[model samples]
Target: MSKRKGEISREKILSSAEYLFAANGYHGTTVSQIVREAGLTQAAFYLYFKSKEEILDEIFLNFERQLDQFVETGQQLNQHNFSEVEKHLTQTYIGLFQLFGANKNVIKIVFNEGGQGEKLRRRIVNQIHTNMTQNQSLGILKPEINTEVFAELLVASIERIAIRYGIDEDYSPAYLGHSLAGILFQGVLTKNT
Candidate 1:
C-alpha cells in the first residue's frame, strides 16, 4: 500500500533530520536546515515535529524501538542451547551488527551529540546487564561473572566495532559478529601460549 502524504512528509523530515544531525552536530543543525533539507516548509516540519529537539527525540525513539525488537527476537541464549551457544551468539551479534549498520547515522548522532548519548548507552548497558543476569540464573553464564561489568564491556566493544567496521562497511556483519563471538568466548590468548 502507498504511504499517506502525511506519512511520507514525516519520513522525509526524519530522514533529513538524521542526515543533518549526523553531518553537523545536533546543536549545530537548525529546524530551518532540517526543513530545507527535507524539502518541506517549516509549517510542515512543525506539523510532524514540534521543535528541533523533538525531532531528535523522535529519531532516538525510532532507534530504541528497533533495538527493542532486535533484542526480543535475537535473544535466544539459554541453558537449553548451551551446546549451540557459539552459533546462537554469532547470529545474535550478526543481527545486532546489522541493526547498528543500518542505523549508522543515528549511532553517530547518539555518540557525538551530548549527554543524551550517555543516557542511551546507560539504558543499553542496563538491558544487557539484565539479560546477562537472567542467563546467569539459567546457568548459561558463569555465576562468578559480574553481569554489570560484562554488559558494559560488551556494549562498549560492540559500539566501537560497529563504528569502526559496520559504519564503514569494511567488514560484513557476519564477519564482525563471528569475530566478536570468537573473541568473547575463546579469548584473545592462544591455547598453546
Candidate 2:
C-alpha cells in the first residue's frame, strides 16, 4: 500500500477502536469487532496494530504526553501573589478539562476500562502533591495544611467533576475552574472575616 493509504487505514483503525472501546468497554471489544467497524480486514488491522492493547496504549500515550506538558507548565509557574496563583490554577483547571473534553471518548475508555487509567490517576495525584509541596516551600501556598491529603482530594474532586460535567455536556469550563479555585482557596463555608 502507498504511505498515504497506510496512514488513512491506521487512522481508521484507531478511530474504530476508540468508538468500540468507549461503547463496549476495552475487554469486551475485540480485534475482529474493530476490523468490522473500520470496514477493514483482519490483515489490514494487523498491519496497523499488533493487538487491541497497542491501539489503546497509543491513544493513552498521546493523552499522557499532553498531560505531562500540562503538569510541566504548572511546575514552571513561580507566581507568589495570591491573585496570580488563582489565575494560574484557574488556567490549569481549564486546560486540564479542555484536554479531556477534546478527547472525551478516549478519556471514558481509559478512565472506565483501562488499567492505564489507574496508573494515570495515581501519577496525577502524585504530581499534584509534589506541586503543592513546592508551593508551600516557596511560601506561595499555606504551609499549615497537610498537602498530601489535599492533593488527593483535589485530584479526586477534579476527576469527579470532569466526569460529571465536562465530558458530555456544554457546561462552562471557566465556571468549573473558577468554582474549584474558590473552593480550594476559601473552603466551602463562607469566611466571617
Candidate 3:
C-alpha cells in the first residue's frame, strides 16, 4: 500500500509539473508551485525527485524510452522494398502523432520552452542517425545517402510537421502520415525500382 501510494504521489507530482511547466515554462515554474499544484508536501516531492531539474530529466527520459521502443520496432519493419517502407514509415508517423497528442503538454514544454529539450532532441537525432547508419551498412537504407544529414533533416521535418498538427487537432494523422511518407520517399528511396 505504501508502495502504491508512493507511486501515486510521484505521478501526481509529474503531472502537476507537466501542467505547470507547460503553462508557465520550466524557468517560470518553481518547486513550491509544483508541490502546491500536486497537493503534496515538498518532502514528498523530494522523496521522489531530487529537484525540478530531476523531474525534467525523468520526463525527458520517459519520452526517450518511448522513442527507443519505436526505434526497436522500426528496426523489424520494412526490410524489403520502397512501397513496404513507405507503409511502415507512414504507420510509424501516425503512431508518433498519437504519442505526441497523448503527451501534448509535456511535448509543448520540452519543445517550445528552452531547457533539456534541446539536449534530448540532439540525443534522439543522434540515435536516429546511428540507426540509419546501421541500416545503410545492412543495405536496408541507401549507402550513398549521408545518414547524419538525413537523420537531422528528417527529425527537423517531422518536428516541424508535428508542431503544425499539435496546434490544431483537426489534422488527420493519416493525411499527415502520408504527406510525411511522400517527402521521405522522395528523399531516401533507393534506386531499386
- Give each model's clash number: 0, 0, 0
Please state every model's RMSD to the true fold in angstroms.
1.7, 2.3, 3.8
Q: Write the per-residue lDDT of candidate 2 for residues 64-146, one digit (tens) a residue.
A: 88888766654755743656777887888888888878888888886796468998888887887898788778877778989
lDDT of 3 at 92: 84
lDDT of 1 by residue, 1-193 (tens): 9999999999999999999999998999999999899999999998978788888888888888887754543245764467887787778889989988888899899878777788888988888888888888888888999999998899899989988889989999999999999999989998799
Q: Is candidate 2 or candidate 3 better by TM-score?
A: 2
Ranking by lDDT: 1, 2, 3
Give the RMSD in angstroms, all C-alphas superposed, for model 3.
3.8
- Identify the runs in model 1 with alpha carbons over 4 angstroms from their true place: 72-75
- Please identify which of the two predictions, 1 or 2, would achieve the higher TM-score against the true structure: 1
Which is the winner by lDDT between candidate 1 and candidate 2?
1
Kindly report which residue stretches of model 2 are placed more than 4 angstroms away from their true locations once superposed: 1-3
Q: Sort all candidates by TM-score, best to worst.
A: 1, 2, 3
- Model 3 regions more than 4 Å off: 1-3, 77-82, 113-115, 186-193
TM-score of each model, in listed order: 0.93, 0.92, 0.83
